[model samples]
Target: MNRLGVQLGSLPWLVLVTGLCITGLWSHQQRSYRQLEHERVERDLAGAISQALTSRLQSTIGVLDAVVGLFDASSAVTRAEFHEFYMALNRRGDTLKGIQGIGYAAVVPNNNVEAFQQQVRASGQPDFTVKPAGTRALTTAILFLQPNDWRNQRALGFDMYSEITRRDAMQLAASTGEPTLSGPVRLLQENSIRPQVGALIYQAIYGQPDRAFNSGQDRRNRLRGWAYSPLRMDDLINGALATINNPALIGTSVLVYDSDRTKPNNLLFDNLNLAGSNKLTHPTWLDVTIANRTWVIGIQLDHRSLNPQGWSNALLLQALLGASLSVLASVITRQLISNHQAVRLALSKEQEVSKERALAGTVFDSSPLAIVVTDPNGVIVQVNQAFCQLTGYSELEAQGNKTNLLRSGRHDSNFYEQMWAAILNKGYWTGEIWNRHRNGQIIRHELSITAVLDPQKNVSNFVGLLRDVSERYAQQEQMRFLATHDQLTGLANRTLLIEELTRSLALARRQRHGVGLLFLDLNNFKPVNDRYGHSTGDALLTAVGQRLLSSVRESDTLCRQGGDEFVLLVPDAPELKQLVAMAHKLVQLLEQPFNELANGAGSIQVSASIGVARWPDHAHDADSLIEAADTAMYQAKHQGGDAIATASSNATL
Candidate 1:
């Protein structure tokens, strides 16, 4: 047969083969695309649900924090005081949707139960008596519940420590000094006829003596009471779902279980009223940590809502179109196979190049570091998403502008010159630089610049990348300050004091000015430490330091020279009379007794013996000046404490 006749004879078989290929490809692509769409939808829905749940819990916790603050500010939070606080907070428009009421539970000893009950009865609850009124070593009684209604009134006088569920969570709160959540439990407010599952969140409050809540032991020793709130599970779930009530959540159900052991016995709340819906085909479980306890929230989606209805119809239409085109394609292939082969190949190559360019564009836009591409003349031609985000300038605004628009003036012209020189000589430069944002804020950036070259070894363009390093730089400076400062007193340590003294001496020499130095030693401080404790001694020292600092001139430097010793440097002094007057004022201030409440101890009495020295007169160097001041200080102590003496005018010390 001739060539055209042979092609015509094989046309039917070619159409069958082409139809099979189209069916297979279309089936695979449609399945993959549907799967991706389902995953994206599920991810978005789950994220929304999680955020709502987190916000709901956080709001309730905020109310509990305010209640704790009230207890901290008062010596004893009376029922009337708590009621007033509750009414004020309610009027502030800060309402927790799922919270039943916020309350306080006082930690009472067994011996004090009768007194506590008498006090509660005196506070307007005539019939109030402790529940489970048996003698225990320690008891926690709910003394006050806000809103003062019948539902919340039932919780008052109930000892939460008598029940294992509440007691466990209270102990955890007391130990951790953080809010804690109880497992599934029935609240006292719920009636036997129509009971609701509930939980409690508790936070411990300590007295003033407990300054360091460092560990569980410390918390246990110092805990005075608990501030807590009650939660109804159904109300909590409803509040969480209120914001996300849409088609995606229709017919869906949610269940929360305690501690990941999801069973009927452990169920905290269940929104699904139907039995069969509990056995979901695809269920997602997310774990949330609230108040130091884990809660597993199960999201069972409605499978019927996810049906691929329109996609199925579209796939059928696509198959019909594919089969019809197969026959047309077979006929066209036989007539133009040789003539159009090169053209089709060329078109395929062009499509592949376009795809490559698109992939590169996606990567460029998605990069985390700020990226800018400039023409050979350093004018910005292109910018990425991160660059726009960093500088607060859109791509349209930044395209025609040079990078010099970001100069903060913190770097001089020579700095830019050096940067460009490095880029030109080595083809790359990397360092820290200051840049200005569009909002007029100066920011620190770790920047890198590279010279892009053409194939002929000629410069074509430049690429720059920047990352914000402002926070890191601030942290470094903070660390440096801490290293040179005393942690206890926040005064200059030995390292910094020596540096300042050296600088001061050098300046005084050039100006031909006199420097006066004084050495101060606290008297009778050891007796205070021995009678009270080191804490009391430390407080006394702190008080004396503050007094000295306030009494001195702004130019003077008062350095804590280790244990109970202090040195004051007075520069630009022309005579000794001013230094003597300052020494007497400081001694008199130190003579005053510190209050017990303010110092956290009994009243303390202390005095200071001060010695004075003149630079280049009694001493030429820092060490000689210090030695002269020390000898004079001992002379003052010998005469009597709280006296000031100057360096001898003798030949030597």
Candidate 2:
């Protein structure tokens, strides 16, 4: 009996060991599967990003080819002709993706410098003269840059041959007869206020019309000029990233390096937040080939943003359940072996198992994710409390209904057909989807749908898990608005104004309509600010913005051109008299006293000096129109205050 008792006790220990071994192996396999799955997902994401970046670069290079074609078709292209070509193909077209500007650079000899300057001066830019104007055997001077706004204007007349980086790229393109990308460098157009890493792509234009660039000697003898475009590295990278569908990439770190070198000096763009030694997770490096040049792109995943969906939680729950079952089995075996009178106690063990199953059900019902279960026929069978709370539907109302009942109508029938196809083919589908709540409000949710199968491999049920993400989308849109508008006045900022002006000018040119521009400068504003403080000045600016907004037509655009400066663009202003009357009205309105709310019982009177310029009359382009208006505004200021001035008719546009 003693030997039998020892064997009986050893049986329980043996069973416990076997259970532990089985659970441990299963857990290991689960972890390994997750790791492998993660790696595959990472690789797929990397390839998608690489393809996007490559496509943008190729498209940008194609724009350079179009620029080359323009020069090839003409023996000598004027600034206006080049500007028109740029507008037709770039500004008015969709080919210029993230390119700063398409510009023309003419190669002039030392003896021809005076003649070149004279030629440029006659081409509408009276101040057109080459910069870094040292005497050289040959110099490549920027002759024209299209969509000539304040930023592009800074690069006009800049001598590219003066800089070795630009010179090297120009020489390479001339010799190869291909688009050559420059190494990382700071653009001449950038100032201390807005510093950005810049690069240039140059396509060579040969002097001999029919000669091919076969050798270095041939290139040197025939090199006439270069058609190039400047690239802000951040703009190019962001443009590429914008095409990606990965939401996890928003906070991910990206680093681009020149020539496969990862050093700081070779760094072209870095989007990482490296403050306080913040390290990246799962960093990867890839070689991106663009126009025969290799750029090393480093991508780092934000592990915190990674989705822990599907099998992870289920694996954990399974492990916990297996371990509990093993413990319960061991206890029951030991109790039964000890005494025959423990039959009731053994039944209690079964009760405990039932209680554990109930605990799992409780966890499912209490989960944060909105989970809904539907039968094989696509009828809702059950839903968790979270689902009820999120969809504003009671369990009683939701049960027996179809998933289509939650459709927001934002998606069409085709979208649903494609979604069902994917789920049927792959057993699961996850994406950002729109659904409607019972309150009739549309909600954006990150949703995952899984199909469960029975022992016969037939569909048993469909389970959906969702988390609301509408607030996140709204916040992203708000951030975009804040980036382009003034916080104080809620009017468009300089960047937005430039874009609007470009679009409006392009439209006017197409329609053969006139565009009127007005530049307004407030008078006696600094004195009021000096006496009452900046709060009063801010109040005055906001009030002025409101008044200006009310005075303009709904189609017109009013922009805060910084500080006390304001600019207005009026479309289809066929008559200058209308512009003059509008300017006078604005001046009269500003001449009224402003009640300072910041200072109780305080009032300050201010006036505005308005300058007006019209397109196809005072100016030929957006840049020229703005310059004319600015020049006239100074004239108005000189003539005292609260006056209106038109651009000089005698001045060349």
Candidate 3:
């Protein structure tokens, strides 16, 4: 009986020992699986965040590229033309803060400064002012040449070039032939409002005829002028923070810096700088370069602020699962425990594998943004449903094809080469691109592409994400029309006309060619408006705009400078005779009777006094060219309405 009792006791003890050993093995395996799962999650999270950041950067680059392309291609960019662009910027301002002003620079002749200054002063502001380059100077002024209520006449003569900092920045931009970012410098224009650095991105122009250089001179040899846009650092930091996916994790600290040493010591941007905080072992920094401007985006997430509940819940679940397994092991003897344990082990391993596969599948299938996978030669390999929706194409149709199936033909082979070069060197490329939809309509999309490298370090696949920007483009175009064009006549407004003239003048100087500027004032426009009411006057103006559009060559520009004043720019004219003949023909066209009217009052006859100025002959630069033609127009008007006058006889209006 004693031997039997001992045998029963040993059986339970032996079962307990076997149960504990099984539990230990299961726990060890579970831990290993969990660790692997955690690593995988971390990697996915990193990749997602990186992709988001890349998309944001690409969108910003696209906007900048559009602006640059417009500046490079168009003869003149008016406030109206920029209206759509400005609105687009404003709409996306949350994504890109800090952008302040966009402007162009034209060489003004030293000789014409006085006349220009007088005109500006007459218009209620100083004509010009100079600031010494590289100094800390803060002063703001406004000038105007036309009567407009919203005009900032105070900024007219403010010598921005005199400021040492602005000068240094401009010089740097000219030297680099690339957009250069300056350290935070105080903006005199916004001084009383808030301390802001003027981030200036400038493009150089050469051979302005208004300067000492003649048409034969190489303007490109010397920097003639520059176009610049200012960015505020504080605003940029705020914008970046707004774009962060996990805003809650952003905490209260952020810092932005320019990594370039040649630039100043100003922080690129700063929100709540926690430079001395103990929670931060090292600053988390992200380097972004767009349009040749480099910025170091830094973020600091406070450890204490992170929610501990997530980790706690995960631990609790782990413990519960372990306990459940142990209980099951204890209930079974060695035979049952071994069998059950084998089943449980297999199930756990299967679950872990399944979870990994699900994670990868979720990443591939559930992303909100469109993703396209292409093989090394730019042939499409696979595309997610998001891509299908974006491109209006099915998976089967896109697969096994070159990306050119969606090419809008808006960009040339050179453009593609440049894109490839960037990607090859940096492993990533981003920009705004126009691609054709399956239905053959052009679609503008902001795109981000990343090169996936194989173990051999060669690019094996490329993943691209695209966001449709057609609406944004439309909005921008609308804004531009509103700002630079006359609503009544649909012709170039004074601002736009002047910009065009200046651009043409520069071109004339470059080509050693002549340009004609014609200033025309309707002879009996006031009488007609007074007699026919304002509505009729508007109709007449619209008719006049149409006539002018139809009468001129494609290279010519016609504009209304308010009231009955009109200016025309004819480029590459050989002599003043051609301009005079065109002006005479225009006058005759206007003098002819018009039958279309709301009143239906038979017909109306109109005539105009015309003034002509020739580039390199009557005037040298934009201001002088306009002034001379304007003066001549007055002379023509003084000589009884229907006539023409040259700048040789400077008659004031």
Candidate 4:
């Protein structure tokens, strides 16, 4: 074989080509990592801005809680009393930082509007009336506003219940008995020349504020009024960014849109217009829910936010790294023998890894057992072909769905909790579970679940292997049936007969009730089997079993105790007369001709000789009971058959 060092060192074109390929690969990897880092930075920036907004809204809402508590402390809050409380709350630093003002609106009914207006006028203000002067069934007028400056004074006595946006928030607050946020609206404090968009959070105050009402209807019925705080969007957004987690969002434009992010009319705030950005900003949006109102907060970050050293430095570094790698490869090519061996070894290892990966994929797809892979959260991420066949869901349908899609409703939540507990604790759980098929059939599965862990020993994914055990389970059930029943006649065999008799005897003894046993043997049956073959004889026994079954009560146990011999057990029997009556009924039933089984065999005839015995009278235990009944059967056989005889048959029935 020729050495690659002898071949490549003699060729300069080969050296240059190798260097170019190496540089291209290095550049591609650097670019890929750069893109990944950019996406990570975008997510981090979005999260930081969302946190700042939420922190400010939550902090401001807390101030309204103190105001609502004032009503809980006093059944009636006078205007002077509300003023004093607001002053005291404001002294607690930064409590009212972003809030425009704190106010209370009184819920007034139309019938009592005059009385409410007179009461408010008498309290302090003489010129108080519900405005803008339209007759409505209910009106919520701004009654008590704190820091009653010229801006807030315009809202006093204004009926907030008349406006659609404010009324929606007030109604929601009253019904839920919780804080509800309103959509964007022009505040009465702003003028048309430079109006600012504003929103409010309303907390409902019910009649008995401490009591937990049953439903929304109950809350609405007991509603007293609402304590609210209004906010100007520009001041609130900027103040939030300044106070909470500063420097992380510095030089970033914060814009908020109401309900929808795409509509320009819904834009609540744009700090870029205030700060004058020279270039268009790209925004990363996060939907923030404030007391049920949705606000889409978008933070537009500069290119420097994506990478710490900036994109220009990142591209320069990529060029530097690629050039360095190419130069080093050229130097190493001079010692071509060692480098060639190393490259060949790396190629061999990579080929082996690729083959292993392909083999694993083939095994997973070809296995008859259904396989599914899920994330740690139990959401299915991958499913093999067998899984689709079993579940009736395609690969596209199964992906992104939770594992509970195939839940049969047979197992409760506790069953799954224990299954997952075992898997997490011991790394695997194997058991039989019931799952529903796509055709709405319940299928039994022999399920084995394994928790796949990463190098750090944290659970990364869950692998589930399901083997359909439906056919195996059905065969098992058939075997179980054969264990306790006579196959020819479908009657209880000796095993089941003994079990039922033992249980019945124990129950009868406890209740002081009588237990009856009737041992019956077919008479004159040997000639028919000899003449018509065993098939006909077996058919006749089945017919006899059906007749005996019809004559017995539901609580009675009838057993075919091998060949022409049968036993009937009756618990809670009243007396010996009942046993004698039942025996007479069976004797007459078997006496009827089996004309249906004639088959030109000249008609078969049969009769039954029954022997009756009662527990606690003839014998106390099961074995002795059977013996006593057997002896009575011999007596009936000797007495020419076709007659009912008992241990006490000497007496008249």
TM-score of 1: 0.47
Question: Worst lDDT window (10 residues) for model 3?
Answer: 143-152
Worst 10 residues of 4 by lDDT: 305-314
Q: What is the C-alpha lDDT of each candidate?
A: 0.76, 0.78, 0.63, 0.78
| Superposed model 2: Cα runs more than 4 Å off | 1-8, 90-93, 110-112, 275-278, 307-318, 332-349, 354-471, 478-653
Candidates 1 and 4, the one with greater lDDT: 4
Which portions of model 1 miss their true places by more than 4 Å?
2-7, 192-194, 274-279, 308-653
Models 1 onward score TM values of: 0.47, 0.62, 0.49, 0.47
Maximum-TM-score candidate: 2
Candidate 4 regions with alpha-carbon error over 4 angstroms: 1-11, 192-194, 211-215, 244-248, 273-282, 304-313, 324-653
At residue 399, candidate 1 shows an lDDT of 94
lDDT against true structure, model 4: 0.78
* Candidate 4 local Cα displacement, residue 107, angstroms: 0.8
Return the TM-score for candidate 2, rounded to 2 decimals.
0.62
Task: Please state the error at residue 402 of candidate 1 in Å.
Answer: 67
Per-prediction tally of clashes: 0, 0, 28, 0
> How would you encode candidate 2's per-residue C-alpha lDDT over 522-640 as one tens digit per residue?
98877776677666667778999998898888988899876688999887776887888888889888877766443565677889888899987898777678878877887888788
For candidate 1, lDDT tens digit of each residue in 572-650? 7667777777788888988887774144555678899988888877888876777788778867877776888889642
How many Å off is the CA of 632 in candidate 4? 99
